[model samples]
Each structure stands twice: as C-alpha cells, then as structure tokens.
Target chain A: MKDDVTIINCQLINKAQALKDVSFEVKKGEIFGLIGPDGAGKTTLFRILTSLISADSGQATVDGLDVATDFRELRKHIGYMPGRFSLYQDLSVEENLQFFATIFNTTVEENYYLIQDIYKQIEPFKRRRAGKLSGGMKQKLALSCALIHKPVVLFLDEPTTGVDPVSRKEFWEMLKKLKTEGVTIVVSTPYMDEAQLCDRIALIQHGKILSVETPEKIIAGFPKKLYQAHSENNYLLLLEVRKNPEVKSAFMSGEYLHIVFNGEADETVPNLKEIGPSIEDCFVYLIEN
Target chain B: MIIKIDNLTKCFGDFTAVDHITFSVGKGEIFGFLGANGAGKTTAMRMFCGLSKPTSGEGRVAGYDIAKQPEMVKKNIGYMSQKFSLYEDLKVWENIRLFAGIYGLDGKQISRKTDITLKRIGLMNEKNTLVKELPLGWKQKLAFSVAIFHEPKIVFLDEPTGGVDPIARRQFWEMIYEAAEKGITVFVTTHYMDEAEYCNRVSIMVDGRIKVLDTPGRLKDRFHAKNMDEVFRQLAR
Candidate 1:
C-alpha cells in the first residue's frame, strides 16, 4: 500500500519550540501511533496534519494533497478526534451524530456501514443527552461521529485519556476493528503500554521523535540487559539499585522495579532476574540516558 | 478499621448511583476503588468521606458515624481531588498555610508543619514560587503534602495521577507508600489498571454494584488473567 500520509521536516514554533523538524510516514490501512508525555509535541503535529493549524515550515500531504493549500479538499478525506471532548454535550447522541454528518455534506444513513460497530454500542442511548452520558459512552459517541463521514484517514489525539480501564480496552478493540475495514489510523497517547497495540509507534519527547518503529523492534533495540525485581520495599529497593555502579537505569513498574545493568550485576535488590523490556521499560531507557 | 461501610446506597431521582454495598478497610491499607465513569464510585466515596449523606445504610470513618458526625469525619480524614486543589496564584508555602489553617492547626504548629512538609517534598527552595509556576509533578506532590499536613488518619485521592508523566507517577506512588507506612490509610480511585495492582486490595464496581473485591493477585487468578487490566476487562465485561 502507498503512504496515505507523508510528512517532511514539519516544524512549528509558538511561545516555545512546539515541534522541531518532525517527519514520519503513515502507510495506507495501518495503525500509526505517536506516543509521548503531556507536554510533548504530539498534539501540535496532529493539528498540522489535520489542517487545523499551519506549520512554520516544511510540508505535509494527505492522500497526495498538500496540507498547506489543499486543506479544504483534505478535510473531506480525513477525520479528526481531538484530545479533548469535542461533541455538543447539550445535544442527544443521535442529534450530535446527525450534526457532524450534515456539516460534512453527508447523512448518518449514508455512512451507516462506516460506524456500524461503534454506533451499535451507543444506539440504545440515542435519545439520551450527550452531557448526561458516562465518560465511556461519550467516547463511543465521539468515535462514531468521527467515523460518520468514512474518511480514509482518522487522526485521534489521546482518545482514551480519562476513560476507565474496561472502557479503554473496549475502545482499543473498536480501533482494531476499524483498521480491518481499511481506515488509516493515527493515534497519539501518553500511555506507553498502549503503544504495543499499534502496528508501529513513535516514541516522542519534548517535540522531538526519540524513536519510531514497531513496538517489538523498539523493545529489541533496548541496548542494556534489563531486569525486573520486587522486594518488600520497592521504593527502598529502587534507591538501593541506583547505588550500584553497574546499574544503568532503575524504574518502578507497578509492583516490580525494572532495572538495567551496565555490566556484571551487584545484588542490592532481591529477586533480580534478567527479563525482556516492555514498551514502557524501553521508553524510560530511551529518555533517561 | 479506618473505614467501614454497610449496605450504603445513594439515589438521585430515578437513578441509583450507588447500590447497597458493604466493605471495610483496615488501618493503613491502600485500598483502590476501580470503576467505569458513572459506575457510582464517586458517589460511594463522597458518602464515605462525609461530603454527601448516604440515602440509606451506614458508614463509619475513624470511629465516627459519617451520617451523624460529618464534622468529626472531616476532622480525621484528608481529601484530594483530581485537580490537585491548589490555588494557582498563591505561593507554594501559602497553599500549605491555607490548608493547615483549615485543618485547624495553631499558628506555631502550622509554621512547623509547613517547614517539615516543604522539606519532605523537596520544595523548600521553591516554597516562595507561585503554585502555577511549578510543574505538574511538583504541583501534584505538593497538593498531596498539604492534604496530609494535618496528619489525618485517612486520605482519599480521586484520580490523583490523571495526566502526569510516567516518572512522576513512579515518584508519586513512592510517596503514597511512604504515607501508607506512616499508618495513614489511603483510599484512592483511579482509571489506571497498573495503579490498581499497587493497592493492597481493589474493588470493581459496575452499574452501581460492587462486582468484585479482592487483592490484585487473587482477582487476576480468579479471572484467569495475567494482569489487572485483563481482570478489570473480565469483570467489567
């Protein structure tokens, strides 16, 4: 498949240097993830690609149309779900969906097949006000609205930020299903674990791309020998592991403290055993050095 | 027990936000309350914290009946919301003073506690800086310090690490452990499945009902899953 989205040295500057010569490509029918923290340039890049904001320099094209001049035409071929909730809270679920469809010069019935999987989940609450819906329900409704137009490419910014664990899992399932139907998905998330869900992910920090590769490849690229350990005192264990001269990095992951040894191991922490790096472990290793 | 609830329920109009539920939390236990949005976790927590009266049933915190002695409950417990609850324009030290005074610390005691807290959270150098100037991680840590400055027996956190970076989240969990070690029971609500694993025990609520309550390991074993994320999906499904 051809590259549906192509970006070259996309740079944007505001009060601070928002993006620094960022460039990447999204192939057709692929799930591309932009993973980063709160202040990272993920949002700014999404804005540029969606044609909501212009870049200071460089170029970005979606479906062979320049994002700079062909934004109006580009809008027709791309759908965007912003980081924050962007639905009419006062409107009912059905009304909001209809409103989005009408603005796109289409009708809900016209793209019924496009949103069938997601829309069916919230169809029971069609008459309920969007404001009154739960966080998870609102997300499904927002996604359905984003899909109403059946755009070839979808840009989702932190689509699962404040949603619960169950809802987060369900939402990702919906994304995967959408991918099978041939939607080019570009999603940004701060959650590192979610990176593995995407076909390929870019580890971004401070408006810069640290690494962009498939989750497995990123993990395989983890340079140091990693270890996962736990003791009665995880915080103390972390402090102890850092004191070791051979240790490169030590981080807490839930109940276990993940460690990276530079050379021969010193036994400051109990139950320290060599292990493969998870996406989060790889991310911390990338940024800490 | 630091917290005890029996058959607690809260209803609004025709909607039952919290169904009849019973649970008890031991002193210094890190208890996690897990739920989908509008699953009645917030309503249940408010009733426990004495901020809202339960429609029916009984709740006791710090040996005080929440329904009858809300003032007593408030005095013995500290609460922190997702927003961190710090005045943005105020200086870092000033926020500590404000909370310390509200918790009824005397003038001399307030100053002593403020110094201790500023030093503990490693904000002694930036105590005079405006709260808004501090980073999200520091702001959250300071907010937690102020909540516990009064030395409350229990601290209730609602989504404490909403948008913090991964490293800050690790440091925050360490602070939580330090608090728990100090014999202060932590009752926290969060959407992060990994955070749930750090708790001593977690309760999953669905549609105003507590579907399951157990240690993370047990919950995972019961659901035949490898992690809290999978366990949550099984119960919530």
Candidate 2:
C-alpha cells in the first residue's frame, strides 16, 4: 500500500532545534506512534505535520496533499487532538461536539456513526459543561469532538499521558476499534508501554529520531545481554551493580534490578538470570550510547 | 506508626468522594497508593495532607490529629504533586530558598542546604537558571529534593515520575529509597504499575475503599498474576 503519511528531512528550530532532520512514513490504515519523553520535540514535529506550524525545511504530506501548500484543504481531512484539552470549557459536552462538527461543514448526525461507540459512554452527561467533567470524561469528550467530522486521518498528541491505567487501556481499545474503520491514526505518548500498542513507533529524543520500526523489532535490536536480579535491597544492589567493572548499566525495575554486563559474567551478583530486554531497556540503551 | 486513619470519609453534598477508608503507615515505609480515575485517591490524599477537612472519621498524621490539628499536620508533612510542585518563573536556587523559608528555615540554613542540594543534583551551575528552562527530568528531580528539604516526618508524592524518561524515573526512585532510609515515611501515588512494585507495600483503592493492601510479591501471588499491571487489570476489571 502507498504511504498515507510521509515526511522528508523535516526540520524545526526555535530557541534550539526542536526537530532535526526527521523523516518517517505511516502506511495506510496503520497506527503510527511517536514515542519520546518531554522536550524530545515530539510536539513540534506533530505541529509541522498537522500544518499548524510551518517547518524550517523539508516536506510533509498527508493523504497525498502537501502540508505547507495544501493546508487549507488538508485541515478538513485530518483531526487533531492536541496534548492539552482544546474544547470550549464553558460549553456543554453536546454543544462542543456540535460546534466542531459545524466547523467542518458537517452535522453531528452525519458523523454520529464514527463517534457513537465513544459518545454513548458520555452521552448521559452531554448536558454538563466540558470543564465540569472528570479527567477521563473530558478526554472522551475531546476525542469525540475530534472524531465528529470523520476525517481521513487522526492526530492524537499524548492522549493518555496523565490518564489512569484503566482509562488508558480503554482509550487504546478505542483506537484499535477505530483502526478497523480505515482511519489512519498517528499518536504520540511519553509512556514506553504504550509504544507496543502501535503498529510502528518512532523513538525520538533530543530533537533526533533514534529509531523507527515495529516495537518487536526495536526490542530485538537491544544490543546487550540484560539480566534481572533481586535483592532484599534493590537500591543498594543498583549501586553495587553500577560499581562493578563488568556491569555496563544497572537500574531498579519493578521489584528487581535490571543489569547489563560488559562481558562474560563471573559470579557478579547472586542469582543473576538473563532476561529479555523491554522497550524501556532499549530506550535507555539507545539514549546512553 | 507515623500515620493512621480510621473510617476517613469526605462527602460532597450527596456524593461520597472518599468512603470510610482506613490505613496506617509505619515510619520509613514506602507506601504506594493506587487507584483508577475518580476512584477517590486524590480526595483521600487531601485528607492526609490536611488540605481538606474530612466529613467524618478519625485520623492522625505525624502525631497530630488531622481533624483538630491541621496546622500541626501541615508542619510535619511534605507534599509534591506532579501538576504543581515548583514555581516555573523562579530561579532554581530561589525556589529552594523560598520553599525552605516557608518551612521555617533560617537564612543561614537555607543558603547552606541550597548549595548542598544543587551540588547533589548536579545542577550547581544551573542554580541561577529559571526552573522553567530546565529539562522536565531535571525539574522533577529538583522538585523532589525541595519537597524533602524540610525533612518532614512524612513526604507525600503524587505521580512524581509521570512523563519522565526511563533513566531519570529510576534515578527518582533511588531518591525515594534514600528518603525512606532516613526515617522519612514515603507516601506516594503513581499510575505506573512498575512503580507500584517498588513500594514496600501497596494498596489498591476501588470506589473510595482500599480493596487490598500487601507487599508487591504477595499481591501478585494472591491475584495469580505475573506482574503488577496484570494484578491491577484483574482488580480493576
């Protein structure tokens, strides 16, 4: 399939270079993720792709339309849910959805099928003001508004950043369901665990694209023999593991400490068991090296 | 015990935000408070911090009655929320000094501790830099160090590591361990289940009540789950 979204050598500069020679492609109907921590320039790149802000150099296209030149027409074909809630605070939930629909030159009833699954959950509270809703409800309402126009592609920036785990899971399930409707979804998040849910993810950091691949391929590329160790005191173990010359890197992960040895292990720590590297482990290794 | 509460309830008109929850934390223990959205964790935490008056029940924090001695409770505890922990416009040292002064530290102590903290966090050169200019990871570390600067009896951290990079998040956990070692009880809430595993004991709240409280190992075994996330999904479902 031809690419639904494509970028070539994109660059953005503010006080510092926000995005550096970034280039990636999202296949048709695939969920693409920009995975990085805060200040890694994920937001700047998102803005450039959405045509909300112009890049300093390079080119981008969504649905075969140039982002810079064809932005007016392109805007109608893409839905953007910014990191911050952009819905009208004083407006009722129902009113916000209607307003967005009207802006796209469509009615809520015309696109009702697109948002029905999510809207129905918050439908009972449609009369409540947007600001008065709970965090989860507010997110749902924002998403509903973004989807009310039935765009070809969706842009969700950190949609689940501060959401609770249960709510985050539910939101991902909703995205998976949307994938079946042939809507190309591009999302960004600071959570490493969420990277696995995307069809492909671009690991970005320090205004640079570190890697772009499937989550499984990224984990497979982890360039070290990782080990998991448990101790009565993980903090002390972390310090001790770091002190060893054979240890490449060590940090506490969950109930145990994760360690990477420099060479062949020779009774470095008690009960050292080799373990598969997680996405977080890969991210740390990539950033360090 | 450093903290204790019984039948703590906070009701807003007809709705009960926190419904008769009871739990206790020993000195120097790392307590993980977990819950779903709108599950009443923040309401209960507010009662613990003495920021809100409970509608009913009894509680004591750091040897002061929460209902009758809110001032004392405030004095004996430290708080750091992910949403708002430090002043963005203030210089790094200025924020430290401001919080220190608010905690009743004298000028001499503030200056001495300010230098010590900046050096420890390796931000000595960035002392005069505004907090907003620092990276998110650095800001989080600075906020944590400042929260414990007063050496309060208990430190309450609400999602301290949210959105931080993996390396920095682990470094932040190391700081939590060091605080607990100094006999400062750590009361923290986080959405990350792996962080829940780092706690000495974790309590999962459901519908304004603590459904279970135990060590991570034991909780996993009891729930027959592989990890804390699985255990959480099972309980939450």
Candidate 3:
C-alpha cells in the first residue's frame, strides 16, 4: 500500500473494535502521530505493524514487507518502545542497552553513533539498576536501547504519558533530530496538544479515526464561531452556556469556559456574556458537532 | 499551612535522589510538583510523608517536624503512590479498611468512612469485588479514596493518573477540588500539562533543582508561554 513504512486496517475483539477499517500511512522520514485517549486502539495498531500480532482481517505492511508474512524481515527494520517501561528492571542501564543490542544481533558500539546523543545523557548512570534510574533517565535509556540496532522505522506508543514536561520536551526534540537523520517515526499519544508537534496526526477515538491532517489544518477546520467566556463562577457558566439553544457546546479550558455558537458571533457573545467560551470553546465545538 | 518543606534533600550512596528543595503548601491550596521522571519530586514527597529518610534537610507537615516527628506527620497526611500500591488480592472494601486501620481508625469509623469513600468514587456497587477484578480507572480512584479515608489534613498524590482515561482524570480532579473545598491541602506531581494548569501553584524541577515555582498563570506570564508545554520547552532548553 503506497510507499509507506506502515499501512493497516484491522479489527480486534468485541471488547474493543480496536481499529475499525483503519488505514493510514507513515511516509519515510516523517514523524506521524496517532492521537487518542487510552483504549483507542493505538497500541493494537502498533503491535500489528511491528508484526508482534496479526490483524483479524486486513492487509498491512511495513517497509515493503507484509506484516503477517515477513515478520522476521520486518523486525530487522523496526524499533518499538512500548507505552509502559518494559525493559528488564533487574539489569543495569548499560546491561539493558547491551542486551537489546544483542537481541538484534548487533553491538552497542556498532550503533553507538545512532544513539550517541541520548545514550550520553544516561552514560554517567550506566551502572545504576534500570529500576532505580529516574523517570527521565529511564526514558532516555529506553530510547537508547530501542535505537541501539539502528532500525529504519521507530514505533513509540504513548512514550510521554507519565514523563515530566522537561523530559517530554527533550524526547520530542530528540525525535526531530532523528527525523533529520532519515528515520521514519510513528508515535502515539493521548495528549491532544502534542498533536501540534508532529508533521501530521491522525485523531482516533473509540477505535475509529475521526480526522487525519496537520494540527493547524485540523484546528482551522473547526466549523463554528468560538469564544472565550469567563465569569465570577466558571463551572456554572459552562453549565448555563451548554443549555442555551444558540450555543452548540461548552467545555472548561484552564480558568475560562470555551463556548461555541451555532449562530452569528455578534449576537452569540452578548447572549453568552451572561455565560462564556475560550479554547475549550473550540474543542467542544469540534467534539460535539 | 498543611505542609512545609525546608532544604529537603535525600541521597543514596553517591547519588542524590532529591537535592535541597524547600516549599510550603497552605490549607486548601492545590500545589503541583512538576519535574522530569527522576527530578526528585517523588523522593522529596516521600520524605515529607515520612516514607523515606532524607540524607539532610528539615521539614514539617501539618505543623509537625518531618525529621523529628515523622509519625505525627504520617498521621496527619495521606499519600497515593505512583505505582498501584493497593493490595491486588484484597476486595475493594478490604483495601479501604486496611488503609483506615493504618491511620488508626476504629472499626465503626472505618466502616463509615469506607461507605462514604466507595460511594464518592462511584465504586460502592463493586465494594465486594476484588481490586484486581476492577478496571484501571476504578483502581486508581479507589486508591485515591483509600489514601484519604481518615480525612487527613493534607493529601500527597504521586503521578496518580498515569494510565487512566481522560474522563476518569477529569472525575479524579473533581474529587481533588472537593477535598480542597473541605480545607485539605493537595500536593500532587504530574507530567500532563493540562493537569498542571489545574493546580493553584506549581513547581517545575530539572536535574534535582526546582527551576520554576509559581501560580500556573504567573508562570505562564513570566515564561511568555501560550501553554504549559511551551513553558516547559523554554525552561528545558
């Protein structure tokens, strides 16, 4: 399917539709994001593309190799970092890196340059047990292990979910640098705001993709007039605005309420002046309508 | 003030988990502790709750010296760990009773508190279910409610919403707000930028030092960031 690093359309069990007729492509050297909340089937998609599991019914391929048939060949070209910390906790940081490298039939020194930037940050703590390293350091160590084999396609599942803001920033910066070096990255995150950081993002909800576009394009596609409204009572304002017939929807954004108007903006603001909307206004408009 | 930390530091061998960091939380304030994974927020919190000893530093919680009167501090504060700390094999009610017992609650008080907590978290219908049988969201909520079973003066939550759904997170925050309204201080650490904005004041730590500490609005203005993510990016650089 198209010269993509990955393409999939599969379904899991009934507990989760888990990718209902989903089809997407990750162009070479591009950072593609799968944005969705937990149980939105992000992990299932990653596993299928990585050839760890086969989809119930769908054609899938990564790097010109069939995911269901060319499992071994596909494994050689893809690196996966699971959402949870899955590296061996009993191993030292250095040992874990070396272990992953060995599993890929490579040496840490052989691909040292590929992971040199991230590895160096945790090199000083090389002797520390994997379980004992700080969260940021653990994240770096995990990335280093993932890249130790110098794979062409990297799949990260919610890599920044629990990471601190600084670590999350550092991780994204590293991903950008990796992209410059010609690596195709496919990362998933539940945080909608992170959708802006990627080259393009596919917004998935309840196992179905709602939209696929650049963050700017998606935000610009917002259909109704939006406004930020704040009053002495923010929560009550949101509840009151949602009940108005002219208002499409209302949700909280930081200290203010974002309200979307179904009618003209001029008339809506005065009516909503008694209530209010802001960024939450834009988000609600998109979600509800 | 519900919590006070002064020059709090903790070290193991040659590595320092938490460096000298000082902060205080007033009653009813939702204080957010922001930091990288290993930036020492957890260590600093543990010390304040008397879970871990500080290599050096002085602290107090609920008007008791942390270093000298750790038991008193423990008695006054509730803690929810980053890891799922509840006993998996225990029923939801049993787990609640265990925590209540740890805080020295009597039989009648534990029963009364357990009923209220189960109902508050919307898990009263599943009180007899084993914790392991519940979903991740329910487990997280139950753990949070258990931590505060004794009506602690202050509650410390360490990455309490890591793997739950967004709707569950919103509900959890509502509970936190309810607690705050009852005059209990909330001390929490999180990586989610949206969650950070909910705190009354926040501290961002990097490399074992607190680099930014202020109300989210003030921090946003001071850093000239459109959002917390941008503020983090600027400070991280």
> Each candidate's DockQ score against the native complex?
0.63, 0.72, 0.42
Q: Give iRMSD, candidate 2.
A: 1.3
Task: Please give the lDDT score for candidate 1.
Answer: 0.88
* Top candidate (DockQ): 2
Q: Give TM-scores of chain A for all candidates.
A: 0.97, 0.97, 0.91
Arranged by DockQ with the best first, the candidates are 2, 1, 3
Candidate 3 RMSD to the correct structure: 3.8
Report the C-alpha lDDT of model 3 over A30-128, residue by residue, as the tens digit.
Answer: 899987655678888889889887788888888899988989988999999998899999999999998999999999999898899898888898998
In angstroms, give how far residue B130 of model 1 lies from its true place.
4.6
- Per-prediction TM-score, please? 0.94, 0.98, 0.86
**What is the TM-score of candidate 1?**
0.94
Instruction: For candidate 2, write residues A164-225 as lDDT tens digits.
Output: 88888889899999999999999997777888899998988878888899999999999878
Q: Candidates 1 and 3: which is better by lDDT?
A: 1
Best by TM-score: 2
Task: Flag regions of model 3 displaced more than 4 Å.
Answer: A5-8, A14-18, A231-249, A261-289, B7-20, B54-57, B106-120, B124-130, B133-135, B163-167, B206-212, B233-237
Candidate with top lDDT is 2
Off by over 4 Å in 1: B89-91, B106-116, B122-135
